[model samples]
Target chain A: MPRSATSSARPAGTAAPAHFDFDGIGTSWQIETPRELDPGTRRLVLDRVEEFDRTYSRFRADSLVTAVAERPGTHLFPPDSIGLFDLYDRLVAATDGAVDPLVGRELELLGYDASYRLRPAGAAERAAAEASGPAGWAADVERDGRRLTTERPVVIDVGAAGKGYLVDLVAELLRGRGYDEFLVDASGDLVHSGREPIRVALEHPLQPGTAIGVAEVADASLCASASNRRVWGDGLHHILDARTGSPAREVIATWVVAADTALADGLATALFFTGAHRLAETFHFSYVRMYADGRAERSRDFRGELFS
Target chain B: MNTRQKKLALATMTGLSISAALAGCATDTPSSADAETVAPSTSAAASSAASTPSPDASSDSGSADASSSTYADGDYSATGGYVSPNGPEEIDVSVTLAGDVITAVTVTPDATNPTAIQYQTQFADGIAEVVVGKDIDEISVSRVAGSSLTSGGFNEAIDAIKADAS
Candidate 1:
């Protein structure tokens, strides 16, 4: 709901809402609310974002994830991380390890490393990475509450769903500050808590500046993922399948709407490798997935319209 | 629990069973020619019908009807078949019911093809396309959910690649 004035016209008397825009976690963020955020509230929101980054960012040298990668031992995360790690646990089981957070090492080997090399590893490097890649989340890690224990070093990348979880966290911050109606947009992931539903365009993966469909989100979260977002080498992208240590090729783009942003975001990535029905068994959500061959499939209950 | 709560729970269980049955043989797999028969159960069909309550029925009368309509506590299994892009596929679905409420469900993939098996495994975890050409500008959208708009690190990577090329 934070469209520019020119894009979204307001009535004569009603003033347009204020939008707080910034960049964090390697992506753009825009928070829209009818009431402007006070300085203290804004500080709280930013601090929460920083705390999340400090805990989960694999790119940062000071992040806890980096510490975990450097040493194999028990690490205690903040209580807030309980939801995230739990969600990852469910995602691993539901996706049959295709959506594991352990895919971080696989991404680094493919040249989407911490330094953002963006270069595909050569055949020899690829073979080595594959041989020593993560041995699945269940085999390598043990999580009890906020305590995560690993037998060996593992690069834990929460890229698939961390952004959306951060959005949810920020939304909670806003609500705690008495801002009940707001929209948190972390780049493409969004959580809406307002009364009126916002119409969101589902961008086409193959065609930039164009959309394949539109989803109406109200009091829910909508998250989108595509193979085109972070492309470097031929057929390489961020959404990777841990089973093959390669980018998923079947579903090129996925849009999921759920009760919360974290689930929506994680399910969006899961849709790339797993079917929506299987996920529905564990989590209730609606989705639309576009295949590499250009055909698109949507859930019967997806609250949106697709342009053929 | 109250009669209304019981009915609501029954409806949800029935819906899940129906959805599982339908999703078992839906789309996304290569075609196959495996013909398998799932033994049909009369109780399953009757239970499904009984799960739907009459809207006008009041609680006092509904309670008695619900008590009489309770399903026999047992496990029921059925096989559902549908044709995919590859060929025909079948899924075996079993449900445990207690007091007419489904307590558990298991969908077993019965396809012989490896691809179908893979798809079935994905299905156990958890479409219409009409082509109407409309310009992006015509639709007024408050925001867009797509591939991430931009990442500073990604941009820097692009710049590094450009520098190397030059």
Candidate 2:
């Protein structure tokens, strides 16, 4: 479960932040604000989530993503999808295709299919899937504004930054409804908007209940990704280095703080394959990455404290 | 200050300690003749001394040379390159030495990609290992962001399969 606690550093006289907790998009969510949300606003948030899932979820048979998988043609996406696709494009370029969204077929071949098989395909089956799967995103898909065109079947899995984008969308909804100071936490992907900075602990990848460090985020987004979270086989995880169609072995976990949740989430995954410095060139963010060898590196500009 | 600045300050302090240690080592082997030979053209001596592959070469020379007790006094520089998972990366390392003691050290990042450059910059800035200390329970944080805890579906499927087997 995603952990949430009131900061011990809160002012003595200040009231505790109100939390609205629920489950959506297959993960737990908690929105922290100064006041409780009315029923109408809550319904709007849930509807938005349902709308996003219906469009992007590859696991759902009726989702637009499933339709894309069934056929090869130009599929229209919602206008808001521009942000998600744009981030994916930049991520693909930044990591040299190591973080491509078109790796859905590869994930399925590795037993992360729609049915949640959790069974690895045979070596030959994996090879055949790789050969038949969509070529590189650039070669396979074309985008004109919100329109996505592909000649061959492609499993458009926006799993990399979709949840973060949804968080952003929900945040926008809350803001539109006049909630200014709030923290929207979609699982571990968080977007905080308020005057006071919120201190967030960076969980240890090897140890579930312990934290490696803390980050102070105010009016920004913090996202973390770890390879151990979704493991099934001896050396299997959800984070795949698309270049090799295998789980990335270098970085075990990563945390990124950016202006937006989508970029932070995407970069968290990108950090598995690419170095933080490379990503910093194009995006303004601070990060902490833990390597498999037990070394943790954080940017100098990273806010908050890290225990040694 | 930025992380690089903090690291540089720490590196400077470490360098001072190293310098003091080397100074102590040099004093144990006070050789006037060796000092005179190295003082005038220390750069030339340092270049040749640095190129010598064997650490025991100073003892082989048979003279109580200052280079034997410590490095030759001068500025020394070297460029090192390595192939990372991303691609080949390189950096230039330069150090200033006085009386066989390193007075200063600097690393120039020569990476082509931004990621490599970032890593190189951090490396150049100097990396201090942050040992884990306080537990999560000890600190007060509003939230914790780590690995997403959403593998419930996968675990449920596994449980169902196990029940069938039983």
Candidate 3:
């Protein structure tokens, strides 16, 4: 939905106001400070969005993702992409290799190569893909400051976690502009700052275009995954198991609220395979899970601060 | 200032805090799979097979029971065809049964991508020949290596079809 322009910028701690839609992330912002998006800030935000799209878009020809597909090895990178690589390492360490980044080769075998294209459906195709060597999260990937290189020419589909990083950057951009109160959302991964808490409705995986529940948090980040989204048809989606070149089932969706977008993004996917019972041992943040059997569960530690 | 901008500011503040909460350092502890020491190979296969129930199945059926009900039978579900736009298009192909042999295939592009139009023009001819006669379960995603990613898109679309039908 589109947002109507405001007559005047409202001061902080005022009446709850109308929502506005910007750059695809739809949520009216509220803040404790009187910071605003000056011309410089606006340009910076737009530029950063463009940079992110160029770096991670699976379709863009000159996107970093494309470059990775063209040449899979450790190479220099722009700060944004390199930061994500570092975050990938963090996720890998946090999840004990469960969230590995070395699956480019396996992902290609599964038909998720550079173009994000699907393979021709046939027994031969399946057999050939299966016959491909078992390439886990170690096939090819290397990154340094402004340099990223891959071992092989495999598609590095960071769709699983790239958006969150972008959101973090957007928030950082706003903060850099001296705006203390703002909300940054990329698709669904979001981060909030300022005084009053924001209420975010977590979309129901089973129910399209509707939210299952709402969570309230101040100055935090939230990433939601549903067994429902990011999947390929035939029950396969993007959330593949690096070890086998297939999707991770068992857990349907996991929403993790944490302090950073990258961690939240990676944790949301990792949680799907981790399951609810094991969340405490595997995850360090609060989470919620919705299952295929119509069961919605949250971690015992998750603060129930939610909006109606 | 306008009401919209005011709301925007507030929203921004709240959203930032949420992000900050998630920004803490990644924990050193591994999730359950690692804790239980489940071999990645065994768990990977199990997870894949188990994820067959497309999460979107219920939503698809509620839209229209007839198309969905008929689709559940092998006839409408077995169809496999691809439509390529310009560069590479995301397509959905499913297997449906008609009579004894499986027939009917679907190839729809992911409208989200800008190049889907181009993919629709170029990739379909080669893809249709590869998938049409295959069983839904037996259908694999490797027959065409040159145009592989598009095939994965077709795979997801077909999976959605089967999930809706079942």
Number of the top-ranking candidate, with DockQ as the measure: 1
Is candidate 2 or 3 superior in DockQ?
A: 2
lDDT of 3 by residue, A1-308 (tens): 22234422345676543333345211122222334456676677667777777776655688776777676566556766767777777666555555666555455555555454544246776676557444444444555566766565655656557767777887887777777776665545777675655555555565453444556656788787765454545675667666556676545666777888877788887765543333333446666655454445554345442212
Candidate 2 lDDT, B69-146, residue by residue in tens: 455555455655556667766665555445565455445677886556645644543352443635678788879888
* lDDT measured at residue A58 in model 1 versus the true structure, 0 to 100: 90
Candidate whose lDDT is highest: 1
Q: Which stretch of 10 consecutive residues in model 3 chain B shows the poorest summed lDDT?
A: B1-10
Q: What docking grade does candidate 2 earn?
A: incorrect
lDDT of 1 by residue, A272-301 (tens): 776555576688888777765575667656
Arranged by TM-score, best first: 2, 1, 3
Compute the interface RMSD for candidate 2.
11.4
Fnat per predicted structure, each in turn: 0.48, 0.42, 0.00
lDDT of 2 at B47: 25
Q: Which regions of candidate 2 deviate over 4 angstroms?
A: A1-14, B1-130, B158-166
Runs off by more than 4 Å, candidate 1: A1-12, A123-133, B1-133
Error of 1 at A18 (Å): 0.4
Error of 2 at B122 (Å): 7.2
TM-score, per-candidate, Cα-based: 0.74, 0.76, 0.56
